[model samples]
Target: MALPVAMLGPTVAQAQGWPTAANPDEVFLYPEESEDPVLLYPDDNSSSAPSSTPPLPNSPNIQPTSVRSLQLIGGEVLTEAIAQAFYRTQLGRPADPARLERIAFAIDQWYLDNGYSLSQVSGWMIDAEGVLTVEVVEPEVNQITIRYIDNEGRALDDEGNPIEGRTRERFLRRELQLQSGAVFNQNDVIQDIQSLMALEIFENATVAVDVDEESRETPVVDVVYNLQERLSRSFQASGGVSTELGLFAGVTYRDGNFNGRGESLRFGTQVGSRGLVFSTEFTSPYRDSRPERLGYTIRAFRRTGRSVTFSDEVRLANGDDARERHFGGGGSVMRPIGDWDAELGLNYSRVSIRDDSGDLAPTDELGNDLTLDDSGIDDLLTLEFAVTQDQRVNPSNPNDGSVLTLSTEQSIPVGNGNIVMNRLRADYAEYVPVNLFNTGRRQNPEVVAFNVQAGTVLGDLPPYEAFDLGGGNSVRGYGRGDVGSGRRFFLATAEYRFPVTGPLGAVLFTDFASDLGSGSEVPGDPAGVRDKPGTGLGYGAGLRIGSPLGLIRADFGVNDQGDNQFFFGFGQRF
Candidate 1:
């Protein structure tokens, strides 16, 4: 997905080819495809050759199933004790030519298993008197050099005028695991392949080896990394329904490999019924050459027309639609903790919550009158920490596996901000494969899914800053905030998803949520006036269409009040 902006990627209706939409405030997965430009996310588990050494021939059957006499030749570490330790079974029986080959291969394998990767044993295993002779050659690295093709596919010398590849030679050298003057280890070659692929800049990477015959006393091996580059930059545009923001159109631009370094830059914007929204971001790894890579991203955004109240998808008959406006910039540092990705971020924003019902509600009075008149600005200086673990078979469309996330936000009243609060949110999603259909494409590996969400806020919160629930994004039947935008909330969903046909799926789902009997802490009794129920339940069925742009969804649901509505959205609700 080339999308850098949230809520702006391609939708099913606009599947001309675009990426997925993410939250403007959240860091999104910007996919860099090596194999497929479309209809593909990333094969995170794509594998490479395990070792440089080719497969050794299987040992043939020797008449005695063992070797009665084995002769070992030319090995610095070979000892009578060592031979006995490995050939005990063969020593007690008669031997044959096959047995001799087996013994020679075994010896060769022993050296390799012991970290002597450069050791080689000649195939001349059988000798007179049913004896086995093995010659072990251990080679050392004399020097390591890289071989790369230029943008034009022309090979270049280390100091040649026309350089090879946009990627810096320095970076590749830093990533190669081989070292001069050290024993050549075949395993290092495999590790190097994975390291390069993780950079997401290469379509493919491979290692080649050449042993110098002139340095025969102790042969030296020259190593080379052959890399095929993927397109580094992309432009994307599409239209979609956000469910949260209604119908919208958007555009995004991205550079996955910037300045030949593994840095990324992205910018995007979308305009919808909810309002205009845009985001810009930049990221770079702390050290691209290392295995334990750390990274950071800086971002800025502008948003308007978002409602923290029960803003229905339809235009209000009263011709008055209150909304929130905000602009901010923030940055986060990210680190991988084993299986989890962790991030810590600091953000600053100014928000205006203006409602013409000024006499009815006032700033700090009922969440500060929402600054509707621009009379005051809500200053939000927030610090956040989040950790996520994703084990899905396919992140974009999972048939099995799970994803978990937990986050915390601390907002301090800085520079006249006055509103202070601490918030926590947790989300978990699980997918189980259960092919129930006997036929009819429904068995494209049908899935049973479960999702749970929980959130809480402490301290006084601005009225405009609400954790609203119930809507197309949550409990279906209810409008936004109908279940009470509150200090605490919990929501859960159960779904049975089955494929209908190629790139199309259907789902039956139920959702339940509660405000934990608590309501938004605004000074005014907005909850009472809004008929907030504190809890809601919804049942629905939906269609999912897969596209290069993203997954598009259409849902028809009924809230607890028997209200029915059709909703359109991008991506899975979870």
Candidate 2:
């Protein structure tokens, strides 16, 4: 006799995916890592294991024995009629072990089909009445508790009792929403554990269940949550190169779990030959209180930089004439509505472009005014609303599932740079899992991904705020800001990805974008200073390496114009 579907524990490892630095001009935004799903339980009592032999009646070795009526025992589900139907043909002949195994499998599958994954057949026996009986053990949760873990790993007392953790029990309880008297549903428990990990306080969270022998009660089981907390405060230094920004470096300091309440505070700065940037942000989720209905985030930043453009001969030129400065601060409130995440926010930005030499305007040799209108200071008070749904198996490194995000911004005409504009954008991504060799492969699936992004702006829109479609995170094969910027754009991508080795994966991708014939609307382009073809096509391949810094990516792209480009950065392209 053995235990019913007992899952000893799940192994956790880091993977990648999720939102990253929106601007390719910036260096990096440290990303949140994801964990691999549980592998199949070892040669233990896991019903997920496939059947070892063929179905009954065809078994090569089976010695029949004379027996009375067959019977089924235990579990609240399944009836005599159902049991009889499973072995209706076998009743005409003598009972055999092969037939009994077949009946047990049917009962096991019925339990699983009903969402009772932890319940399964425990044993089989023969009674004095020559009757055969099969026992199905449906375990129920007797109690639940949690233990906090530190850097040295999980701690325990001499008796093996879990040591209390620093995180409050109430916080864990609110996410779990599991009752002691309820039946154990593995799917629900796994999802709750994921939410706990989402708190960002714990490095990993695993579940273990034990037989409650002392209770001597209806197959009672004890559930324990082992939580490993990550360092609350940490510092990271990053460096990267972009054709426009040249060689740039940055430093970041963060408190991921500030004040023991799941608040996050981060500050960062990047300086290079072409620009200097500084940013600070804080996020406070209702982790210790309720759900995300009360969460909010605040951010502020300053970006000042120069431009590289084409001169009179439509020749590449790095000029000091157009120097740009932008200062902005914004805040957003987030709430989880059913399966969708909703956000409302406001942002204020001041932008201005100056001419170091009034005599050095970016003009074509043809004497046309390459300089755009309103190069002076402008102010924008933008109100934004957005909603998103993430259904990926691993949001950071998805193998399957789909994600959709939609947002809009409305500017109010007020400040001296009073600007009036409305913008709408949508991004949709879908992933399909593939396993060319299905029998045995890595736990994570090889995947094919598709993504679409489209946006438009209506009103008095500035070039800086307009959609630019070239960068590591955008269209490849072109340097950041090298591609044209305009009021309307549509971009789509298709990628195939697979693991070449542990922690190292590869992807082949194709990306295409169109300016929707808005080349005329692209400021500073009418004079042929920068080529804006209205349509672009790029294809490339890249490598994804999992490291302490999340996923480090390198890509090489070739545009339709035969131009080649290489990109290096942190996080996934999406």
Candidate 2 Cα deviation (angstroms), residue 344: 0.7
Model 1, residue 293: what's the lDDT? 66
Cα distance off (Å), candidate 2, residue 445: 4.7
Model 2 whole-model lDDT (C-alpha atoms): 0.65
Q: Write the per-residue lDDT of candidate 2 for residues 1-574, one digit (tens) a residue.
A: 1222234221110011111111232221111111211111243243433332233232334346555676777646556666555555455467655445534554554555455565666666554455656566667778887777654565665578866665667756877855687776666676777688667577557777666645575677777777877556779898898443557998989887676666889899987675667889999874433663578999999865554333113431343445555689999998877888889999998766544332233333344333334335677889999999978765666778999999999998876556788999999999998876452122234888999999999987665576777767777887665555667889999988877776788889998887787756745553124565657788999998866445678999988889979999865677
Q: Please give the CA lDDT of all the candidate structures.
A: 0.64, 0.65
Candidate 1 TM-score to native: 0.60
Candidate 2's displacement at residue 280, Å, is 0.7
- Those runs of model 1 whose alpha carbons end farther than 4 Å from true positions after fitting are 1-264, 269-277, 285-293, 310-319, 355-375, 438-445, 520-525
Best model per lDDT: 2
